[model samples]
Target chain A: MQPLPKELLIEASGGDIGAFEKIYRATSDYVYTIALKVTGNRADAEEVAQDVFLKVFRKLGKFRFESSFTTWLYRITVNNAINASRKSTRRRSGQVEFNDNIEVADGRDRTREAIEKEQNEARVRSMLETLNPDQRACIVLREIEGMRYEEIAEVLQVNLNTVRSRLRRARETLCSRAQQERSIQ
Target chain B: MKCTEARELLASDFLDGELDKDARGEVVKHLDACDGCRRFEEAVRRAAVDPLRNAPRETAPPSLWLKVRLGIEHEQERGVRAALYRVWRSFHVPWTAYAAASATAAVIIAIAVLREPLTVPGSTRASLTDTEGLHEYIEEQFSILAYQDTNGTGNGANGNGADSVNFGTLLEEYLM
Candidate 1:
């Protein structure tokens, strides 16, 4: 989607819903992706996505043009997403801990080589499940999503160094578990 | 720093190349000497890569984001419409009381402006000081009342008083 114009957004802040709708369409994906990545569940992502829009709608009138509209919206979404993830953490930790009987699916491969690769991948995901949501999210964003450290920091509304540090710590934790699994294997 | 602080740094700082040249050397030396830290490094590398590489690359369910965006705008539209409706509702009034007060005021002012002392039409009006004018009209009427009166002698110079021309007897004699 094309980036929404800041000028159109300024017009929208004066109560132009039609203009704001255009801005919403342009930027909703940007917000939703951050939610999906940060919160790590479709439902939480949806809730966070809805919340971002509602906040944007309510606060649109108050948005003075002191900062870039995109950056402002980015900050709001990041802040909302981070808060949602934190709340989900307490609930999520319970589910993972209490539901250890979560039916582990059979590894999806038959060939000897494919089975090994699938097994390794499965073990990786299992290990990742141990991370707190924020750290898990940082790992995903940095390694798989390939976002720059600065961009991740922006999406999480954290300092770039925080993003790097979290990534490193998360990686170390996962590596520790993987090594233990290797020892057992 | 103790091994503990160094471990914390090794976890994050080593990744960033943030360690001073000497600190970096020490961490490398420690990693060469320590089995625990090298495994930590290896685990961190795997944890960082696996999910990104394998956890499903998801775009949101199509048009869901579109719907949420439209929905917020719709909500905003309704809010403005509600405010406008409230302002419009405020303009309606109970007309009877206001109308009645206005009508009564108009009637009282009209009466005050129109009321005046009565005047006779088509008359050169006599001033209030002309009381003598009414008395003079009565004096002019004195000649009009002068009329012949029959004396009790009844103008009876006719030989006998009885034969005198009494008003009634004279009429009788004429008739005879």
Candidate 2:
């Protein structure tokens, strides 16, 4: 995400819809992507994104400019996604399966490339489902969003060593799952 | 470095490029010596890291922003209603206080009036009768006064040769 201007944030905090819309346009891609990756399903992702933006809209006034806006937004997005995923976990099965026939935002592509992209995304989502919400969050932030360990620790509000351990555990689980799937195939 | 320790670092700092120069060298030495640790690192990367890093970035649906805008508008409307209710409650509370204060004042005044000494004419209140021997004492004093008046030694109406007043009638007139 690009660095948002302090003036823009201040304006949005003062209830300027146009300014807030700009902020949304700028950040919604990563926000939606992170939500999708963490929750492992489109419906939950969409719900999480909506909730995240609403919270940002309401609580923008309290956001001190001392930290980066992306960090703050990422924290909110991850927390909401994890909570949504956990709740959906209790309501039905353990893991919410990613919908394979997910509609792409870019309708321009009906080619094999688009299909490949969708399949790849589905594979990633399936792998993420094998971990618990906490480990899944660590994987999404570290692997997908490309956040540093320190940044992830700050966003997840855990110590640095905790982040390291979670990422290690999550990757190890993914490795075993992959091996199991390959053997079965 | 042990294979177990090398594998931990490979899963985290080594793969993330966060390992220090010396630590990275040590892990590299261990991986070079251990085929199992090298295979484990490859497996972790293949399974977890590469696919996610290569996954396409998803955009927010066009409807999401519209939904959020509508949600915010609804929230603002709810907030306005809440503010109006608070205002109404503020006005309502003072009237309740006034009513309570008026009822309390009325009760206190009623109690004070009931507790005052009775001075009504011909009134025979139970409280007066309940006093210890007060009725007998009053009757005796009236009898003495009547006797004195009859002998023309008291300033009473019966002193002018009027028949001595009946005690009960005098007592009633005194009350009046």
In order, the TM-score of chain B in each prediction is 0.41, 0.52
Model 1 lDDT, full chain set:
0.65
Best by TM-score: 2
Tens-place lDDT digits, model 1, residues A69-180: 7667766766777788788876754654443333233333256765665445445546656676678667655555555677667766789778877876676677677667
For model 2, fnat equals: 0.90
Give the clashing residue pairs of candidate 1, or none: A144-B52, A171-B44, A172-B44, A175-B43, A175-B44
Model 2: per-residue Cα lDDT over A57-160, one tens digit each: 99999998888888999999999999998888754233342233335444356787777776687688778878999998888888778889999999999999
TM-score of each: 0.53, 0.73
Candidate 1: give its CA RMSD in angstroms. 13.9
Those runs of model 1 whose alpha carbons end farther than 4 Å from true positions after fitting are A1-30, A65-71, A82-129, A133-169, A176-185, B1-6, B16-36, B53-57, B89-176
- lDDT (tens digit, per residue) of candidate 2 on B112-146: 99887665355453345456446765787799787
Worst 10 residues of 1 chain A by lDDT: A100-109
How high is the TM-score of chain B in model 1? 0.41
State which candidate has the highest lDDT: 2
